[model samples]
Target: MNSANGSAWDDWDDEVDLLVFGAGAAGMTAALIAHHEGLNVLVCEKTAAVGGITSTSGGTTWVPGTQLSVDAGVPDSVDDARRFLQSVVGARGGDAAREAFLQSGPLAIDELQRISDVKFVAAAAHPDYVTGPGAAFGGRALAPLPFDARVLGKDFARVRPPRKEFMGLGGMMVNRNDLGALLSPFASVGNLKRTLEVVGRYCVDRLSYPRGTQLVMGNALAARLYYSLRKRDVPVRFDAPLVELIREQGRVTGAVAGSADGSRRRIRARLGVVLATGGLTRHPVLRKQLFPVAAQPLSLSPDTHTGDGIASALAAAARLEDGGDSPGLWMPCSIRRAPDGNDHVWPHIILDRAKPGLIAVNSRGERFVNESNSYHDFVMGMLRDAGDGQSVPAHLIVDAAFIRDYGLGLLMPGRSRARIAEFERSGYLVKGDTLEQLASKLGVDAAGLARTVQAYNRDAAAGKDPAFNRGASPMSRFNGDPAQKPNPCIRPLGDGPYYAVTVWPADLACSAGLSGTANGEVLDANGAVIPGLFACGNDLASIFRGTYPGPGTTLGPAIVFGWRIAKFVAGKLDQAPAGERSRATACANQPS
Candidate 1:
């Protein structure tokens, strides 16, 4: 039904050597690599801007065995990372694609550094989210260096700004170091100087740009990749969305794309068409089928990720990987309404959840999960806690000291207790003079909450969390307040006044996608390759089998597989033989 194998009709509006269907990190990286390898490339973005979900992410790419890891003194290797993934994901997919990712991840990063402006630095102490035989303390995760969007000049408009709630001072973007100075500008002379410089630059940028030109995190990663492609003159069409693939003579040829003004064009691809259109998270039918009913209508991914690429691939007879333990990567988010009538979903990601003096509880007012755990695990715990039919959203209970020290979801740290009045009025923040009062306001069991707090405070004072073991892992401690004594993630809530923000589970990215070969070719249901078609990014099934191994689990495989797809199309990649693929898959399926 998807392939058009009738009489050949070649009335193309435009043609290129490679047609990339998304402008996200994966698509941009693929387009850049292909252009450098002598292919004329075109990147089509569904939205009017670049940086699909990547612009709002942390932009950390997890690639092991790189020279940067060695230079940073992190003793990590590909073998260790493999073991880590195997333990977390089990025998899913037999890990054929995962093994390919391990072999090429470091090489992909090195090639990007050598051929493009894409730069990354290994974090010295960013521990893995879980501790085990293959886990390393650091070096496997690489953060993209901040970039100046001013370098793009007018082209800066093409880059999507981060989520509105994430920006400070209206539209000013702040890096981690710059934010520290901005928050405590009056604390020290150095902080004041840095704040002044940062603010001054942002003010100047606001005159010409809609947001601050100083980009960091995922925005920086997207900007750097976009700029590199711009330098190479690779044309990226804004507002052009792929409609369907053009198949002729038993091979996928090009596509029918829709334009901004609602016109469609028949475009041709000489070499190949790479499907990297985010994922199927927003697809109405697929989302209902893949996500939990509780997770409906609340996804952190871009709205453009409506499964267009995957749907088109399915029509082309591509098979999908079935039955992943976790169909989508998750985050615990607290939402707030903006003046523009849009809801702001603030992801509780390594911000305040792991700090001391904070606790998350269910409808019964009982702690169900370790508040200091990774966001994914925390959300998984939330879903598991719902087995008893509590219908109520999870509540994170904190106090005045917690707000001033670590802040709640959208609340900034070091803010005064008085600053919470506006939030309380908006119903985003709940307050009570006592634990009983707070329980009433939050619809929680009053006596159960009091008992939980009494026991929690006593244990916290002794620097332990026996109930849920909050700070027992390397990840929990790494993201916790290092200043806290004994156990950095443990602390008792003070007397009297209490506050809370409701937490809901949200999907950050979809892992279920089209099944493909290690060489990046789209495979049909019968295990036959679809000529001239390939997939990457969220469009390709996750190598981790929907398991969250660590930071950049999604982007790492996205870039590696995308690069390999381009190389394979260029006839420069060495495809794994049938026997080798079988043996590798079998071995990876063995017990950890």
Candidate 2:
């Protein structure tokens, strides 16, 4: 084999049955499945860390019809799942990709749990993001069981930590179930015991490690997959990025990768190559092309995701899907500069908006959205109301009571007076002594804000919202604080020391990318499959198009298609001639 630059290269540097381009959930799943099928696998990651955005995510998978859900007494069927997707997606890209996802998602979850340490539990109370035609109040979303990161030994450092804003007590990770205990540590004896147990574990783990080892959410999911890979002795190379896709007769067979020192090597993959390099959210040019508006610098995804995989696939003549209504999944994020002068982003997933006593208002100090809706829908409201960027930075208004109970972005509840003073002094939170003062501080019309609050308080007293119907839907109430009576998402913004935070439109994941078939094979401009090449994760065009169906829609399809590609490659390798198999084995055994 000779290099493209005409350099003499008679032998390959490395070879494997399958070469995976990214180390996120999709690529790791593919590598693990391939290794289990008696095939040699290699994973190359562009960043210094292994997990992509998946490590920083919620780590929930919206896979229906799983044994976990069945055991939890949640009734879910494939037909129902299909109907749910169809109702949300609605003839966007046909039903083939959605059908593939529904059939393979449960099987992928079951097989991974059987073969590896990956375990999942059903989130029985989590509702679908929308209360559409086929929405399920329960039995869809599954989160990874909490994992002990100490099992990874020294390799734990390779797992990217969760977002700083998502962590608590310095660098300790907490799940949804743990938040209640921590919030009301002195509420009951059991609560106190649970809080002490969690804090004690974190305190002990922090003595020897930079962060706690009690991993949850996306970090747990990524660690589980990485642990399975290490157990199978799969080799993963960090700081190695794909430079080119090697092809033979228009079929992608291998890749050229570059090292940190600018050195290059050719690695032949006899079976196939999988692209799972997150998505195109961070690519400035691509973001401009795909997004409805010019994207902001802030994103919920890790900064390492720069659309390299999407670019490579496009250069190989892969087609990008542009028929979706929106090209990316959105979330409202608040940014605050740390002492180190770097911007820290806090994604508003489940914190302040849905809780009672908070409302989102535009520049005119007018309420624009039902703040209790999902993050995606909330941001869509922002975009729709954004007339020439007026709503780009929407204001979330809350009162002293709300801030004391629920807290605002980056501002935890039950803070001491000193801590509140620090946040206000640092300009992370804007506080005013009255509604008119708060409106002035937020640069909105004081009269408009006062009128809005007056009407809202009257409705809250009556237990109904005539405007926007804040708590009318199942999803709205699902995210709302159940402790609040009447409407969980509606309350009067009363008292002094009102606060406001500026939120910008940020994408959690892109809903559009390379077009691919149901089998995960990349498709060209004419919708023809590009043999020996496949994409999964955010690298592949989303099955739901631009619509968000549920909590784990992105990750669910990613895991399933990753599994699908591995199975497809294994079958292809089995049908290859003996000589080709021998060459692949010989090449795989060669030393770097």
Candidate 3:
């Protein structure tokens, strides 16, 4: 979206109090908040569906000191979260946005629930990704409560589906909590009961729905926000991408949107236009300039993201900023040809990596990082090792026992036996009758692979990881199998007939974007706010300066800033303090 040609537009085809450039969590949330304040809002979605990449995410929100935490009786305070952020990200450029996020997170949550259909439940045992001063073992991260997609009736189809690889049983979206029950239905009566109910519901749902109607994780969050908008009758134009920002005498006041019929319409926002168009992940030019060339950056964001909002903002005098520790939040994604013959990318975020009996190896077949660490951290390790470009396309070496016990990516436990040949044929799963054969097939140094495995096995037996401390962190242990050993994250390589999956660093979202303020105002290069121009979601530079602190880091800030943008436009940005903020300030004010 460029403003050079947009300046010629004269009359408006449509008008609203607020115009949102995306239909993702950030944009939808902003529209919802603005609609609640009696502002007429319209959302333009680039794709046919409502959710962006977030619909495929884990749907966690790491906002501290909410009623959900108190209701769950989870011990947490905002001050602790603040200190945790400070430890992980010291003196970042977006400190104002960070403090604003901390102060307004709980308040935003409260305001959202009071006015919209959004709901969250405190996670009982979610740990922060990094351990630092005042780090939370739990309580800070909350998950979206599972949403019954049937509420939307036919409109449910508009909610984007999760990645094909992430789903089970032909589009059944089984969440983490119910996975064990589904995997081992007869193991216990409770398991059997839940499995039966779940499967039975899916069977009935398939009669009319393309997928199961019970949605969880990011899908649920997206659906909830979408339903809130629908309830308010807010108009959302699908397949409409922002073409350009309409600046009236230096302030962004509207946008030109493109329709599927190849028509363009100037939609004016009486209050302001909010840029929330995913991010620069798919932008042809910006991706190269910002991403590390050595790391071979890939993105999980939608194809339609393509820098529409950011480009439009830049054309309107909004400045883009970069130079963070990392250009984007990353995951080690395993790619394979799916049943539909499309290349499927599975983000190795939580499953199997931290489990026993798997070690990630570079081209030389040596471990370069802690396999049990967070996905973002793990990919950062990959970038560090691959800066010279020789260590990339790392393989996750696993024994047959590891597959049997904890299935590799896209392979459900016990299901690999039937699909192994197909996956192997597709070059997705590499199998070896012996370690040497596997190393040769994977083009890894056989001698190096042997030595690495030997050292890892010795360390596993002793329940220690002196090299990288794989299982030392609380978060690492949380991702591991607790039943296994003294170190839940470590186990020796089992009997041969090993397998390996190739992985590459993929960004889940861009860390850099248009410079913006705590009030959601996009700024010029001189640090002055561009009047009436606001950016949220990934359109704004990350508040943490590219440091991933915990689960829901992306969604938490997006949702909060969405609310802040709406409040600012409605002239109520400084409304009476939420009780949650007072508690947070009180905790921060108290002496050590």
Q: Candidate 3, which ten residues in sequence have the lowest lDDT sum?
A: 579-588
lDDT tens digits, residues 155-184, model 3? 998999988777778988898989999988
Best by lDDT: 3
lDDT of 1 by residue, 1-592 (tens): 2345533545678888789999999999889989988888988889988999989888988888788898788867999988887787777764777888888888899999999999999988888887777987799899999899889999998998898888988998787767778888998999999999999998998889888998989999999999999999999998999899988765677888899999987778877789999989998988888877776758899877899999999988889874387778899999887666778789999878999999998888899889988888888888776666452379999988898877898888787646788788778889999999999999999998999999999999999999998889888999899999999999999987999999888888888888888867788899877877889999988877767878888888888888887776665666653432322222212332
Clashing pairs in 3: none
Best-fitting candidate, measured by TM-score?
1
TM-score of 3: 0.94
lDDT of 3 at 217: 96
Candidate that beats the other on TM-score, 1 or 2, i.e. the better one = 1
Task: For candidate 2, list the clashing residue pairs, or say none.
Answer: none
Model 1 / residue 493 / CA error / Å: 1.4
- Poorly placed runs, candidate 3 (over 4 Å): 1-10, 294-297, 575-592
